[model samples]
Target: MAQIDTIIASPSPVECRRLQNILEKEPDFRILAQARDLSQTYTATEALSPAIVLISQSFAALPEFEVMHMLFRVLDTRWLVIENGDACTPHLKITRNSDLFTIDLRSGGAGLVPLIRSVTRAQRRKMVPARPVRQSMPGQKKLVMIGASTGGVDALATLLSGFPTDCPPTMIVQHTRHSFGGSLIGLLDRQCAAHVMPAKDRMRLDPGTICIAAGGRAHMQLAISHAPQVRLVPSAPVSGHLPSVDAMFHSALRVAPRTVAVLLTGMGRDGARGMLELRQAGASTLAQDEASSVVYGMPKAAWENGGAQKRIPLVDMAAEILKAASMSGEEAKP
Candidate 1:
């Protein structure tokens, strides 16, 4: 069994000791380090890349907490935050922004162990390879629609890098942090031949430019017209995600005369049903094969739910896209 390493960050030495004691009881967990201050926490995290970071509420008020939070999100590290309360009624807070899970610290910390175990299980799943699969999607693709979540940054970079400067107009929806749209587009722009940028509301969909769904409290959809454009609308979260892939996929079904939908690595089933709808509407659909996904959950869900018409490896996805676009038959070997 693989063991999970952790770093405990607590402003109070007594609270740090208490967490350490509780964690020590689990055979599969190892305490890598403990920090009582911001400086120590920074040094410890840099020196030892722990799987999980247990943070006490005292650290939340400091400016350093913001930096640490960003660092953890970028590194894909799990954080569990213990609320500021005594043993009787401790609460835990978990959110997409904070990337932390809150739990009651009373009852001799019974809930802590299970939470850690669940986190470890998820991490282990990410480490494992996906099984082999084969799928086929045939269409004359005019517009390309893509959806991704975990591992999307790297996957998009690789896929777009193979695209020609004259590639078809492409729209993408990726689950990410607020204000991360610029950074993601910038990163992708550096790696790909096609221009990459954030989608502007009412901006015309142009050939050779890839528009990414803006990250925030809205769903990014397309407006039907002589010249289709991107539109951001405030709405309830669909499939547990704002800017949901499902929303984008379902929208593609409306304008499906010549479109292709591709679903990539992510967790949950947000895009599964929507992809199925696109396929039923005569649009081609593709999904990332398991072996290459950082998390196979989303693509797996899409494939299993009869949403994906083709399952392709990450290395070959770009070639496949170009092939579907009728750009070149010579590059279809992947």
Candidate 2:
């Protein structure tokens, strides 16, 4: 694992010292500097360029913090926000949330180390910024977006097994833990002909390769690029997920006419509204049939809300997805 350099910034001197002490105990973490105010935080960050920044919610609410945030984001610095006065942290927010996390300091500082580790791991995935979009491509491009949760591991293995080596660019958001993401990728790669890998920030989406966002500290979204790159942004959880299906689907709206969006077995309604928006934007959309889904929560919500154009069985899902993805940009629209 790469070393994680960090900056501890807080208006309170006590808070800064607290974080410095906690991080010092970790073998992987190195503190570049500690700041007593937002001003010093900016100076240290500009000089040291730390991998992560530990901050308080109070400083983040300040106007200057926003501008500094914008400047620092280009450097790939992820934030760990500390909030005071919470009875305790939310279970979902702390354990299974995005890289840019806010935890209740009132409970304890124990959550800080884990949050820092998650962000550090996420950074190693090459979270770069997206390049500017090109005007046109010689050949028409097609994209696929799939979302899954509960029982998704087996379901994804089965669905991906049917894809050809030359299949369209596909991005998937599957709910899991950050710690288990590498194993998930390895498992999917072994099961499928297409190259299955963790989604990198600004990675070019290409045919025959699949990028997955599962239990990462960031949200994976489609960004403007010649090949339509994946952009990973560290943010608060969306639809109760860090690497949320909703974020991915919503981000692809501009390319909806050339997209095929699918919702599969999941325990929540994360992709329902996003799928509906995609459908309305002329994308081809589908959901897994209840009988085929391990848990039918997400697909059911999508079907009920008129988000899915069809509900196909798991056995036929790969075939249907392939068909949609093979369509010409003009031919793919609803």
Candidate 3:
């Protein structure tokens, strides 16, 4: 594993020291500098050039808009913000009900473990080489399904933007807070070339579209009858997530048996079992390799459970999916 250099910034001196001490104990991580305030943070980050920056919510006091702007400008690095109690930070906000806070870091202690894990994971992504695309064989119908949680907004945007307008019809399971799903879809629609919208109940699957599952009471499933459609399964949560990846993959297995299932960066094992099922059903399955994952737990679980046929970096995923789908189509042609 590559070494991860980090800068710790907190308005409170005690919190800064505490986070620094925790970061120092990790063999893979080095505390490049500690800052007592925003001014010190700017200076330390510029001079140290750390790969990640950990900012305590105290910085949130410096005008929410200004704080976020400054944070983005100073450190073109991955940012993790520590919140006070149940309070959240505008920058690096963890969505409600996401498994981001599941780590057992001490209270008011900056949750060093999750921060370190995020940084380490970011470093891994930076190291993977791009994969070359194989020539398309013929008659292949490529499909892409993605599941994401915690930090998914930016992650999903990054993953989707690489795809062209003619890319495969993609289904996404983004674990979002209630009422936020629609806005997220709108946001993604504007950012990417493909048409992005929330999956509607009983709607026929279409090509060249991106459907996102609703975060409310409904989970998206595939109805296997003629003109296979998206079904809203109002069921219990599996693996602690609603609109679960397990549900999506299971549906894809029945509907598009040969579709490619991709388990992207997320916080847990929600997609692992389903991905394995997809593999068993003769579908090609891929997991976002650890180096490019925002949180490696999901892809790691899929890879460990023998779910992934290929583990590719995030940047190359869109091209790979296109190549694989095109090849599959050619192979199926009479």
Evaluated with TM-score, which candidate comes out highest? Answer: 3
**What TM-score quantifies how close candidate 2 is to the native fold?**
0.58
Candidate 3 lDDT, 61-121, residue by residue in tens:
3322232333343244565666654455443342322222222224645456655676447
Model 3 compared with the native: what TM-score? Answer: 0.60
Better of 2 and 3 by TM-score: 3
* Candidate ordering by TM-score (highest first): 3, 1, 2
Give the per-residue Cα lDDT of candidate 1 at 208.
73
User: Residue-wise lDDT of candidate 2 within 1-334, one digit each (tens)?
Assistant: 5789998888877777777777888898988888877767877886788888888767665433433454354456888777755343332232232345787666668677887787667643343433222222224357999999876766787798777776788999988767557656755675567789999988998887799998799999999766689999999999999999999999999988889999998888999999999999889999999988867899999999999999999999988888787777567655
Off by over 4 Å in 3: 1-140, 329-334
Candidate 1's TM-score reads 0.59
RMSD per candidate (Å) reads: 10.9, 12.5, 11.9
lDDT of 3 at 108: 47
The candidate that wins on lDDT is: 2
Clashing pairs in 1: 92-102, 92-103, 93-102
Would you list the C-alpha lDDT of every candidate in the order shown? 0.73, 0.78, 0.67
